[model samples]
Target: MTDRPERDALRPRLSGGLTVEVIETSALGDRSYVASDGEVAVVVDPQRDIDRVLAAAGRLGGRIGLVLETHVHNDYVSGGLELSRLTGADYGVSAKDDPPFPHRALDDGDIIDVSPRLRIRAVATPGHTFHHLSYVLEGSEGPVGVFTGGSLLYGTTGRTDLLGEHHSEELARHQHTSVRKLGDLLPDGAHIWPTHGFGSFCSASPAEGDASTIGEQKSANPAFTLAEHEFVEQTLAGLDAYPAYYAHMGVRNIAGPEPLDLRAPTHADPEELRRRLDGGEWVVDLRSRKAFVKSHLAGTVSLGLDGPMVTWLGWMIDWGAPLTLLGETADEVAEAQRELARIGIDRLAAAATGTPDELAADRAQLTSIPVATFTDLAAAFDSGGSGGGGGSATDGELPAPDVVLDVRTRSEFGDSHVRSAVHVPLYEVTQRAGEVPHGTVWVHCGSGYRAAAAASLLARAGRDVVLIDDSFDNAAEAGVPLES
Candidate 1:
């Protein structure tokens, strides 16, 4: 039972002349890595933070010799290609089936000799994705461990509900075949490392324990215990609603991926940014509401500049439509560009020109407003304030036909809720808001962070919104009736 905190330390062990590293990608999609050899390292499927991987390789004083992806990830953007270009590593993915993207495809029997003792064998495993593969590290002692990717988890395996147009029947069949193959090929004692854990939507039962043995997984994994038909039913049952943005990636990957140049986007200019926006480009400002409210280009939407940029943006932005950036600074603009690249969002026409004011000379092209602080928001809610700059609702008043939008997780919402409140989690608010009756909107989360996101999303979409501003603890303490 290797704990996650220990595995995340990026300590590489010596096997023959090779050094191996294991890094963990946190809930927000940030990753850290390990480097073993002085000039050679292997990078696993990187989350959005490429700097962490690069910094790890730089500290080891070795170039990244190989880039590996265990599967086609759905929960977060895969930064495999970006790190490969940055570290000069050869990218590797399974060659058994044609992947959505191009790479130095490897087969089931393929082996890469990074060093004398460190050879990685690509094992074709097809449950999570038809092309998903796991890499087994053959050390002198025996097979040390395998980067199982989404095929297997700490307690569960990856779900097959993500196969949009692809036949779920065929995909489920492949998944069943894949895990059985993995169970046979991998030694019972072999170490198992997977990408997701608790809080991930990809697996309902992501293990709290980080790495487990193949023997342990066989004993514990629910998917492995079922027959093919039963396994398919179990895998598809009760999957959370996938973000709307996921339906487009398969086609994008089938086309060869174009490398992104971090220097500056070619299409970024004042007129071009406007043209793209006029052309229906979705302007995503990767800055805080404070920064955004201080000044932002007209017709821009704010989603902030961190974690799951690709995942959330993919959910929000249309792929063929153009995009523009409102970053913190010039450096952040570059970070945003790289973040978009992982999801194949390459249609950037230009960046925000000069300053918000300089670009707003036309006046129609600019909009700025005062942002309410959380404290102020809380106060307004206490006094039954409507917060639309209109007037306050009287004490004990529900803003006539007011709809309380619970932005907490479904499980959290199921646990309890305000009276007559509609439940649409922050994740699904963007897609499901059409169902919200045109009336006052009051949003709340376990805390206020997610509620703020929900409110802002509704506000940008031209909905009248307010914040409940209740902490989970306080909401319960106030003796509010919980549904369950």
Candidate 2:
């Protein structure tokens, strides 16, 4: 088992007797918070990992009195139901959400007194979702802080397109009004505690900083600085594709996600691993990209633990596809299992731990891909090594790539990219693999991680691939042509 440390909790002291402890899930780019007043606590927008929330509350020496959902999350399964069941806390969800669970239905303007000193007032803040609510933490003096779930983030608001493109414009307008409402409802000194926008895709754009207050946001946030139409226009224009796994999250949350199962999965022998691979199950290698590029079993995909493994794997795999994990140690596999469970991938088909040689039937089953830097790529392209005319090169020399596949995001591709690279974002690689030009394909992304994953996918699709294992910043420095 992995001897992983507990999730880091950032405890920020609020006015009055309250203190807010932040439980961050950095992998998912989201946060859950526990607001405690010495004796009782409230948990807001927790990820499926309930243990982190419990640990935070325990550290604060407070009993959990309430579990609150800001909205029906589109990114991850909520642990609210399970947490409430375990702690006997009143689970508070928006009344309009009508989730199929027993809880205290919260409406706009409803106030719940946790003690004589601390009270939570629910305020309707629509836009990220139709029924989103922001909870204001009120002390005897006035409001101290507000938990802005997906409504008002650090610098930007939550993306309005998660519901669907049809409602995007309307929601964007609503989002503008909602953010302004918060600014007007609270004093400038009230601290702003938001759930999304700390590198989360849920944010309309990238978030600016780690912390802020209403006064800080009023000076910098677009909703406060820009006109309503301008804010809506910019917000809608910034929309991009989110993870495909998000489709399952809202449905699961509304239906009430089952408790997480973190027990070790069944162990698979070499023969069983081969059989599963041959039968088209996803056999993911959870090694470093360098190790994966050096050697892996044929037909297995590389989703190195060094990268956004959970996000990319969940994005690329079929929802119910049987998944088998390969790692160097039991601890590595356990860590991956915990990460997967956060995104509602609670069960693994099987797992194997060892070198590729040990997991393969023979040395013949092991294969390695060519790894190249941007400098090598530049030299190859400059030497008249272009696509379509290739016999496989002998020895370790890569044949000039037939195609340079840019597997970065659309926004990244739009900003600047290799002059002649074909754009196919990593998430769309499986469905659009056929469109890639034939011959040896060179794959690259912002960093080597996505490129390695794309290279593996291209290899799995029966194409010869060279993994560009270097940073994109080196492209120009290494003399690879770039076009904006």
Candidate 3:
């Protein structure tokens, strides 16, 4: 498993006695904030895991007095309601959002006084979602900062398309107006703490920098710098596909998600594991890509815990389909479980922990995939070996692959990709697997993570596959033909 930094590593002190502790869920690329004023704390946009927030408040020696939600989040399940229930803090949700649970119906211009020195004001942002709110923290002197959840990110705003395509354009316009409103209302020095866009697909475009100020954003942010029409057009045009699991998040948030369950799942023996695979259930291998490529049980897809396993697994799997995890250790499975819970995939059918040999019924159940680099791929092409068809090869030159499947995003593919590579994004690989031509398929992504996952899916489908396990940056340098 990859080494994760402490979640509350970034504790930035704001004006007055208030200090903001950031709880980052890097797997999902979102941050939850715990703003404490020595005695009392207010949490903003918390993830499903509340223990981290509780720990942040504990470090500050404060009581959590308020929990706030910026909107009905489309990315992950919110911990606000349960956090409020656990701490007896008043839960705040936008008045426009009709969540099933009881919460303070926060409206625009509403001020919540946590102490004599610290107060929070709710401002209707209505960009990322129609009911989105940005909370401005006020000190005795003036406004200190704003929690712009999915509204005004570091350089761009959250993608407005999550609501649906029909509403994307309208929401983009709202996003434009909302970000400018925040810029106009806040002071130049006011810090902007956004919840999304630290590599999250929620971002309209790639966000820049870790920290930003209202003044800086005004000059750099599309909403502040571009005309309304231009901003709306640009945002809508830049939109890409988000995780399929997202379709369930908003609904779950609105209905009030079940309390988190992080306990260990039932242990499955090798025979039980085989049964799960035979029943058409998803059995994900939570090992490193290299380990998985070396050996894993057949029919088990590689979604290594070392990468964005939660993101790709949620996107590629059939929602609500039974899932079983195979990890090298209990901790690896536990970590994967915790990440899955963030996106509201709570129940695990079962899990097995051991080496592939320990988990497989026999040697026949074990399999391996050939790992290659971009240079190796280039060499294969140069060798003029016929594999899959449908490649653009000149006379005497080998076709790119039986099929050269580019599993990166459309935007990445459009930027520059190997010549004649088929473009099936990682998210669409499950349904579109048949579309891939018959032959030895060579799959690649920006990095090897998605490629490994795609290769596993192809392998599970009984297709011969070679995993190009190198960075895309080396493609051109390695003499792999590329075109924009």
RMSD of each: 5.9, 2.2, 2.8
lDDT of 2 by residue, 35-131 (tens): 8988899999988879888988998889999999999998888999999999999999999998778989999999999887779999999999999
lDDT of candidate 3 vs native?
Answer: 0.89
Write one digit per residue (lDDT tens) for candidate 1, span 57-147.
6766777788887765666555676677766678887665466544788888798887654568888887767788888877656577777
Clashing pairs in 1: 39-62, 100-253, 127-175, 267-349, 268-350
Comparison by lDDT, 1 against 2, better one: 2
Q: Clashing pairs in model 3?
A: 388-402
Candidate lDDT (C-alpha), each? 0.63, 0.89, 0.89
- Candidate 3 residue spans exceeding 4 A from truth: 1-4, 7-9, 385-400
lDDT of 3 at 466: 82
TM-score of each: 0.73, 0.96, 0.96
Q: What tens-digit string does per-residue lDDT give for candidate 3 at 19-41? A: 88888888888988888889999
- Candidate 2 ranges beyond 4 A from true positions: 1-9, 387-396
Worst 10 residues of 2 by lDDT: 1-10
lDDT comparing candidate 1 with the true structure:
0.63
Query: Who is ahead in TM-score, 1 or 3?
Result: 3
